[model samples]
Target chain A: MIKHDLVIVGGGPAGMAAAVAAYDSGVKDVVIIDRDASLGGILQQCIHNGFGLHKLGEELTGPEYASVYEKKVRERNITIYNDMMVTCLTADKIVTAQGSSGILKIQAKAVILAMGCRERSRGALNICGTRPAGIYSAGTAQKLMNCEGYSVGKKVVILGSGDIGLIMARRMTLEGAKVEAVCEIMPYSGGLTRNIVQCLEDYNIPLYLSHTVAEIHGQKRLEGVTIAQVDENRRIIENTKRFIACDTLLLSVGLIPENELTKEAGIPIDNITNGAIVDENRQTLVPGIFACGNVLQVHDLVDYVSDEAELAGNGAAQYILNGGCKGDSVCTEAGNGVRYVLPQRVNTGTGKDVSLFLRVTKPYGKVRFTVKSSENVLAKAVRIKAAPGEMEKITIKADLLNNITEPITVELEEV
Target chain B: MIKNITCIICPKGCSLTAEINEGIVCVNGNTCERGKQYATDECLNPTRTVTSMVRVSNKCNCMVSVKTVKPIPKGKIFETMELIRGAEVCAPVSIGDVILEDVFGTQVIATKNIDR
Candidate 1:
């Protein structure tokens, strides 16, 4: 068995950042294993701009943002194993991977889970339709068009107004294809507001809020789709049904963190975030193991992923050097108007500021968010607007957490 | 005339009201100076940095992502896309390599590296 100081699964943005951070933080022996032929993960196919604004201080395309980290990893002389799929991770930090050559086992002192996320497919939506050839996930179509150099379809109707769906609408239009419409089951769009304007409105594409694809048409290829308005509870309104003729259907409903290995390792999972429950350092319940990026929670921007991964990387380095963390942690709870918060537990004794990342349950205008312990308010901030599509962050100074034994709660008040 | 513009300069997406009168513009509801500049420029002449992928030859990767060096007139986006669609690049392309130069006074440079 090969031994390494740290092993990072998935060579995407998170893994690259974690490896770099860990290497820079006094841990020289680090290895990254990725299932792809090359590094960069999903960023390779994401050719569009609007990435790296916060993290790198420059607006870049997905590939450009990833290249910055890739260069850093290479400069550090860190070892990378491409086309290696990690099949199993043990509670004791043993990682088993299979690649083109053969099966390899590694006994790692610490592990960082950075597997990212996957798109929810048509099967999860349960839209009544015959299996057709023209249906593809927005991400799959993006790879086909951007990387494989293939036009996915001529006439397309997109389901779900998530960023990918909105982006694909613009992409299809840019490629001289007709985008019929984009439908969202929720009253509010799940995508960033900029996407709705730049991707749909810029191209004169109509967005049907509170609507969904009721039935998919065609047997061999996608002929059309039946759309209908949904009630507040998301049930289809039968009378509002209408048919849109299109050769393709793209589903961009949602993304779920890929955590099969995390589960196999028996790490506790959060029901709402669908990710591993982590602490302020991004360390999971398992000692010597950390989780970050989309494996911890789906983030709207890659910048946050890099930042979160750095925390996990530092946490792993500390774990390796100091053996392990020992302290009482204060539990964090999502209070009114909040969906969930990351770093479910905060170590007050760490003597470092803790940033609480969270999302609201729904969209709201002009709100004040308060982070409070039972005894005193820890931090507070106000925003002009808040939405479920966007992740919110609030940092609590370490000095303020002294002698606090109550669970920290994040609650929002509408102004 | 008054127009509402959503500033796409950042994710904050501030909603700005631009009052244009006699070629003079006044913007409100902007939290930063960048937002005011964005609103004024948007009302006068909108621009966008076009990003796309071009065919690559003699590389394991079939396409290399490219983007304009500077934001071009929004009206020129479709035309720029047409020009990009027909463009192809040979292998050993590095990031910042000019794929197509002088595209509306700006160059379309590669955003990704493609090695043969």
Candidate 2:
């Protein structure tokens, strides 16, 4: 058994950032375990720039930003086990991982969970189609093109208008492939507004809203696909059916936070985020175990992932040094148009101010975000517009929090 | 003079309009302050990310792709690429390693490692 001051699971943004932060924060012994042969995780395949805007304040590609942190980690002499899959995690912070080197057990003073996320595949969608060679996840297609240097197809039809799909549409075009059309089942696009402009509009790719692929036609490889507009009930409208000739199909349905290890550890999971329930400190219910990045919640930007991971890493270090945060605990709730709150529970008396991260339940214009205790508003911010595609954050002062004896609730109400 | 600018600072690509009146650049239509700067400075000089494939000298014969540690002026992209082509790296080389301390006085690194 290898014992260390801290053991971090997953070598993606969250894990890498956490390890770097912890190491920099005075934790000499830190180890990171990842199943992939290398670091960067999903970012490795995301070759397009637009990743490091907030974190690095520059337009960097996914691999570029990840490399920034990766360099810091390597320089710090952080031990990393690649090609290692963690199968089990314990409340006491013991982890069992299987790698090319065989089974490895790590006992640490603290642990950070940053396993990131996985793509939602066809099996999750119940799309009636035979498993064909030409069908690929948008992310998988991206990896093949950007990393493996293989063009997925010449003519392609993409299912779903998520960021991954939209980006892939542009990527395929850059590689000299024609994206026939991008179809989305939802009336509202799930991707950010800028993505629609830069990745789709600039390329003149048609977007079909409230539409879905009705049937996939092919025997050996994908020959074509039949698409149709859907009613609010989501049933394909027979009159709207159209056949699109294509050699490949890519699905960018959604992403699920990889939480099997969290579940195995008996930590509670959030149905909405599909990540472990964590506080501002990124500590889960299990003591000495913290979570961050996509493993905590799906973030739209890699910069935010690094920012959140820093908190988790510092929090874990604090726990090791002080034996954990102890004080009156207060609960946080999302009300009105708000979707959820991070740091679901707070150590009421901790002197540090709290930064609450949240998302709106729906799109709103001229809205005010209110963080209120039972009687008084702790903090508020007015925004000209807000959308579910963007995650919002607000800070509450510790001085104001000290006056609250009850749980705080955050809400987004339109003016 | 009026200048049209595209803010590539964040994923929110806010288009902006800039006018140089009385030697003071006034910008409008930006979503944030960064966009304002992006517009005002962009009119004087444009900047871009430098990304290209470089031959790995010590690792596998395959080419290892690279990018500037920081974005340089748009006009300097080809110059930066020229400097990178002459660079070589040794293995047990990890991804993100600084292959060149300062190419044209700007740090550049390998984003991925080529295994030997």
Candidate 3:
């Protein structure tokens, strides 16, 4: 069995950043394993700019941002096993990964789960249609167009208004494809406001909110699609159905965390995030096993993923160097207007400042997020606008965390 | 003349009104300082940072990603793309290497390293 101090399960941004952080933190023996031939995960497929503004303080494309981390790993001489998949991960941190050669077992002192996420397929959307040649996921289409020199179709209709779909609308337009429309079932867009403006508004692409595809028209290669408006109940209105002739239909409905390995490892997954449940350090209930990045929750920005993975990397390094950072942990709850919060539990006595990232249930205007204990109000941040599309962050100082005598609750207060 | 401009400073997408009186621009409805500057810039000379890929030969992957060293005029996007379409670079290109100099008075620099 090959032994390593730390084994990271994905060579994406999260895994690369974690490997670098762990190496810098005095944990020299580290390896990053990915199923792809190269590093940089989805970032490679993402060629658009507007990344790394927060972390690196400069606007960078997806590959540019990822290459910086990949360079850091190479400078540190971090070992990597590309084109390898972890078949099984035990609770005790025994990783069984298979590569092109054969199955390999590795006993890791700590494992960081950075497997990231995958796109929700057409089957998840429940659209009644024949399996055709023109249908593609937004990510798949992006990979095909960006990496491989292939365009999916000449005429496109996007079924979801997520970032990928919106970006693809512009990409297809730039590549000489006509995008008819972008339909979103949600009242508010699932993508960021900047994308809506730059991708759709700039291209004059119409975005139909509270609308969805009711039926598929073509038998083989997606000749057309029937889109209909939906009422408050999200049920399609019968008379509002309209057929749009398009050769391609891209689905950007949602992204689910790739957690088959974590589930197989028996880590407790949160229902809301569909990722592992852990404390402030991004550790799972299973000691020596930690999770971060999209495997923990879907972040609106890649910068947050790198930040969270650093926490997990430091946590793993601490586990190996000076045992684990364990203390009396307290639970955190999403009280009002909050859909869910990450780091479901926080150890009060760890004496480290903890940042709680959360998303609201609905869009609110002129609101303040209040983080409070039973008797004490910890901190609050006000915003002019708060939408489900944007993820909000609230930092709880270490001194406040040290004095936490009750379960903390985060509530949105209308100002 | 007052023009309604959407501030692209961040994702907030604040709608601002830029009123010009004797060429002294006054921006209103901005939530942040960057928004005010963005409004003034948008009203005066709108510029955008262009990011596109260039063909790389010597079998070093498919393409090398590049971006303008500074924001260029918004109208130069087509001209820039036209030039980038015909541009090609050799292998072992380093980040920040100027692939096309004097591109509309700005250089198109590589953003990432590509080696064979």
Candidate models: Cα lDDT each: 0.93, 0.83, 0.87
lDDT of 2 by residue, A1-415 (tens): 9888899999988899999898888888899999998898888777667887777766677776778888899999899999999999988788999979799998899999999988888778776666667999999988776666566899999999889999898777655689999999988777877788667875689999999998888888889999999999899999999999999999989888999989988999887788888777999988889999998898888888999999999999888888778777788898999888887887776788989989888767779999999978999998767777778889999888775778889988889
TM-score of 3: 0.95
Q: Which candidate leads in DockQ?
A: 1
| DockQ leaderboard ranking | 1, 3, 2
Write down the TM-score of model 2's second chain: 0.81
Provide the lDDT at A389 for model 2.
Answer: 75
Q: Which parts of model 1 have CA positions greater than 4 angstroms off? A: none
Deviation from native of the Cα of residue A209 in model 1, angstroms? 0.3
Lowest lDDT sum, 10 consecutive residues, model 2 chain A, at: A142-151
Scoring model 1 with DockQ, what do you get?
0.74
Q: How many clashes show up per model?
A: 0, 2, 0
TM-score of each: 0.99, 0.86, 0.95
Task: Compose the digit string of candidate 3's lDDT tens values, residues A1-415.
Answer: 9899999999999999899888988999999989998999999877778889789988788888999999899999798898899999999899998987478899999999999999999988889777777999999998887766476799999989888999888878766789999999989899888788778886789999999998887777889999999999999999999999999999999999999999998999999999999988888999989998988899888998999989998888999999887678888899989999888998896777889999999888889999988978888999888888889999988888886778889999889
**Stretches of model 2 off by over 4 angstroms after superposition:** B1-8, B13-27, B33-63, B66-116
Global local distance difference test of model 1: 0.93
